[model samples]
Target: MGNAAHEEVIASINSQISETNALINAALVAGTPTDKLRKKLATLHGDLKTAQEFEAAGIADEQAKDEAFVLGAGTEIAASTIAAVNAELEALGVVCRIEQGGDRFAEVAHRIAVALRIHEKVREKIGEAAAAVERLETRINECAARRATITAARLDGKSSDREVNEFVALAADIDALNGLLYDARAKLDGIDDSAEKAAVERLRADMQQLVSATLIEAVTVHVAQAEIALLDGIRKLHRTGLKHAPHRGSTPRSHYLMNADLDFFCRTGALR
Candidate 1:
């Protein structure tokens, strides 16, 4: 029966039960035999109980339907939320893969956290890589300028005190440049992608060649024997892999120079 009709049936049964009880009470007060009225009242109460049970069952059925609809809606929302978060991650050049199942709300929340973490890490690495490249390029230009200054001085095989002092100073500047390059290359360690790392390494190689060529030019200028020895020592140390010396008690300046010399030797064939 329709819900409204079923409710009407229950109300009708309850009204009959009440009327039967009133007739039974009236017959007893009139001192008449109440057996038939009492029997009718008992039958009405039984009918009322049956009707109420059916109504209770119908209400439970309706509640179940409502809960099912809500669950379906919740599932749809969870799916859309995951899709949106995945799209955002892809825009940031990251891929998010999540296995489906379990509590959907919890899964979506976890996916969002994972996507955010990946995006932040990639951004941080990219920034570091760019900064490292910039630093290396800047130091390369600075070294080039210093080399030009030394070239213009034109010592011409002279052994004068002033010529020796100038070569010594330039050697110190070259040392400083090497340290800067090393520090810049170290920053590349933060990048995890093989292709990106390889591209930066290639650029590092090119920069190393430019700087080593500058060193070769300086050596050919016939500076003091002592200054020549100093330049040669720098080359040999790098060539023989002494640049990877232990880091105990080393200052930042020393650490930067220590790792950069190897790149110079590797690119220039200075050992040959």
Candidate 2:
């Protein structure tokens, strides 16, 4: 990219990061509740804000400095959230990687990341969710085992009534932990999906930097389909003979023609 393009992209990211950071600070102050996080998220990005203010151009003076600061803070906050979430996930993933049965879940999570081109850090966090569930389940099992042991000992009346009650209470604790674990696991299932959405948002930001417009079009062409047109052009030239194909002309013209062909070929996925 040219220096201008680079600057544009960097500025856009910085603007968003700053705004996100601001909201993060606000959230930290208010406490990171789900509702507050959702509210912070619905705010517009820098590009969107700028475009929205397009009508202000005719004013005596229009300053974007204040707006920039808010956007920049928010961007930073969002980025930090992504990083923390990912780190938690990564730790969980490594912890639960021992068994092949657990690995299937990891694989499924990984597939979601790949399908969405999610940032690697976020994917790591998504993987950790399952690990957390596994840990919770382990805790529940431990409580159950302890309670069972105590109950069996009670068959001989070796334990006190208070001790039996405590064991029974632990069983209840296990049930509560299971409830939390199941809910956590369900939330984790969507983390990767949000990561996918984040990737798309990243792309949208990039497009805005390139061309500040919200209307987007995705252009994709299979190699076979794209090549068909080129092949058809060549076939037409072959059938029309040398006269219709045009002459090579002078040395300068020939060099220019060859270079253009090379450039087009490179862009058409031939080299790739």
Candidate 3:
């Protein structure tokens, strides 16, 4: 299949996935008919079938790629949900630290408000964190493309400008991220457990290495975080092996309630 076929297949499969997820939500929560669940499942099956055919005809080896999409959406959703849980737990911890129980002087509502604000900041940070990972992926892709070696003519493909820009923008604040982590480590230093501090250091080091490719470190980080973009799919489909950084755990699912954000907007680049 040509590039047009590949793009169209991607578009169609993404649309089907989005529509099916919407149907599932409506059935479960919106008082839709009971039979709609089966209809939605059938719709998913059909979309997956079409996606598989497209994979087989156009891409060289697509089983992994196709399954990766399914697995990634699932992973992204599960992981992001977990992250949110962790965030909530942390907020509760903060609340506990502050709510020492006193007269109205304690101002419990004020503490709650502060916690909520921090929660919002953390949410933005998670997006920022995901953005950082996306940038690293772009750099890796650019490096790979620079070294792109096509041994045959018919198999030729190149990176698109838009893809490069989008991926890079997601990771644009790597340096600021490093600064934030460093400050966290400093604030928590000497007061927290040494092991926890050590863990923070390890994370800081890994993130720095991911951003700094020219370093002579003993290890290189593979990108663990990525968006469900077509360029990303193409990268994986083309066998672009990542050696560092897995940011999948940092994804936020709240924005993609019902997984529509993950499927329709993210995959189709309609709301990117």
- Give the C-alpha lDDT of model 1: 0.60
Candidate 3 local lDDT, 138-220, one digit each (tens): 65555444333321222355555565564455354544555655554444342323444454455435434432332222122
TM-scores of the models, in the given order? Answer: 0.36, 0.30, 0.20
Relative to the true structure, how large is the alpha-carbon lDDT of every model? 0.60, 0.55, 0.47
Poorly placed runs, candidate 2 (over 4 Å): 1-118, 193-272
Report the candidate with higher TM-score, 2 versus 3: 2
For model 3, where is the 10-residue window of minimal lDDT?
214-223
* Whole-model alpha-carbon lDDT for candidate 2: 0.55
Per-prediction count of colliding residue pairs?
0, 22, 15
State, as a TM-score between 0 and 1, how close model 3 is to the true structure: 0.20
**Candidate 1 weakest lDDT stretch, 10 residues:** 247-256
Ranking by lDDT: 1, 2, 3
lDDT of 3: 0.47
